[model samples]
Target chain A: MKNIYSTLPVIGILLLTLVSSALPANKPPEKGGVLPVINLPIPKNPTEKVYLGLSGDGFFKIPQIKAKVVIIEIYSMYCPYCQKDAPGVNELYTFIEKNPDLKNKIKLIGIGAGNTPFEVEVYKKTYQVPFPLFPDKDFTIHKACAEVRTPYFIVVKINDDGTHQIVHAQLGDYPGADPFLELVLKASGLK
Target chain B: MQKIRLANLIMVAGMLSVFVTVSMAFAISDAYKGNIYQVGTIKPVDSKLVVKKGNQAPDFSLPSVSGDKVTLSQFRGKKNVALSFVPAAWTPICSDQWPGYNIIKDTFDQNDTILLGITVDNIPTLFAWINQMGKLWFPVLSDFWPHGAVAKKYGVLRSNGVSERALFVIDKKGAIRYIDVHDINKRPPLEDLVGALEKLGK
Candidate 1:
């Protein structure tokens, strides 16, 4: 009886170890956490520089747009969810472009986690993505952004002082481009 | 004596429990192996080159995504072949390479070349992955049964149970014209493949 009692603890510990190790490592960042400042290269144009930071809960600084609301997509070319969401992302880009007021005020870019320059190009060309898509080949940008899941979208509000803050963050695809644009506008305090 | 025998029985039971738990852990990892994404920059591999240009390409029949066996020899006299050996399916680099090739179907068609994508993953895994990219223009062959037999034959199989990210261009005469065993973690430039095809002169 004493032997069974001693062995029971050992078995229990083994089970616990197995359960803990099997769990997934990546999880979405908290909704209200500060968006880290990280240097990200421009996907379409590598010569330019871009920085992600926080404003008074708004404004992100990207190339071409000094102060604008930004929608940052943390994606991977190998992610099937990202692949499924490609057409919708393109639609979102189109919606932003067609709007006269929102076009210049907002920018969309994708940071492909662990994707090489060539891999990022393949994604953009294959999906006909018009927005700037950068490669985070080393996961440096990805880790700085809190290691969010693929197809993760973060809306940032760029402040007048050139700082930016994340207004909203979400995982998975939005219902459609219209709803997504509305969310971006609302998050940016424009709506 | 009875107490000692019971102690031994408990010890045996405890060891068995540990073994079972460890086995379960391994099984879980294997099942979700496709979901594990490796991050950061991977250094280029200095592969031990085995196959050289102008050698007759080794022939083999493997199961493809189309539910039919694909024999490399079948296309010997009919078309030039580009054998794309990716490390595995669902990883960062391998996933994008094939889709990138998908857009350049015209390039392959123009060169009279048939692109064959080979990976060490099985059919179901390949099917589930390729389905997400929509319809692929070329056939994706699995070297899973013999666990990368074809990749081994070509000398591109890595020690880690996967193939290196390699590209072999075979002329219609079944002679290897070009061989590019790229860095396992990097994507070979699309232009390089196209340039090689252009050099093939048809």
Candidate 2:
């Protein structure tokens, strides 16, 4: 009984130290709450709330990109990771083509948000992207989306009432179109 | 006899406590996440001269995919090594870019350069993926175990867990002569790499 009573303080001190050390000492910044958002205003492009722009071909309305679901692909032309993942992007484009329903539900747009507009244009031309790519030169669009990294993927879902919601956001690349397709199908209510 | 038994128990308990403390120290070191920079002055490893100019050179011993054994260092001195670093292998950009290195294996050989890729990924995952991708020519080095120790030593490992995609033209003396660190999203120009090699050869 004496030993147990004497050991209680040590045990309590150990537990307290462990618990205090385990907790984060500092809190991370809150999204949009701080003045950091003041750096760039959300893109009021009008067609797409944050991501949409005038179609390079001048055929479709900014938000009316041909699919029930839209993918806003954020990338810089010079990022090796982005270049390495270029084949997967091509594969995704092919994957969408193979699934008519999935294709109808999905629209992938390449956004050059990282590099200069000239560099982005050269990259798009070199890669021969099938979808329209817009250069977010000043990062207004990026600021609007609150994007933090290159090669980010944002899945935009169009509601029946013509409003949009960010259904999914991914920072890094994952292979195959299955994961992306599933998200699109789920968001768009496509069978 | 009772005193002897108690002495043995105390020694055993002391040994066990020491072992626990050592293991905990190791765990704390391993639990280190985020980037930790090398504590010394940044070393400049660019523009030096050495041997093995334009010839298939001899190989050396380095860590293998499992990192358990050293297998693929033989290509080191023989060919010009395109020391490529990617953020992580599984991500989209790394996935596409590593295979692109494979696509240019013939070109690398034409210049007598063996393209060596490095990342902080553990040997196990790297072994499986390299085998899956069938990247036969390039031997990917695992900067794991020591936890990107090589990258940290080289001053390329970012404050993040991964190292930046930096290209180093390591000469035959194993001294890096040309160093280029690109933006995370940018791929180093292959032409610039070739030019660096040509200049080194000259």
Q: Which candidate wins on lDDT?
A: 1
lDDT of 2 by residue, B1-202 (tens): 5544554555555554543322211000101111222222112222122223343323333466644443334444665566777766554335434544555555566667666778888877777656544434667888775887666655677766677777777665555567777655544545667678776676
lDDT of 1 by residue, B53-125 (tens): 9999999999999999999999978999999999877676676667667767877988999999999999999
Q: What is the lDDT of residue B100 in candidate 2?
A: 40
Per-prediction share of native contacts kept: 0.05, 0.00
Residue A67's lDDT in candidate 2: 54
lDDT of 1: 0.72
Off by over 4 Å in 2: A1-68, A74-92, A95-106, A111-152, A158-163, A168-183, B1-78, B84-110, B117-137, B140-166, B170-191, B194-202
lDDT of 2 by residue, A1-191 (tens): 55665555555555555543333223221211211111222233453332233334333432454456677676656444455566677667778867765656666777665344455555656566665566655444444444344566666665566556566666655555667666656655664
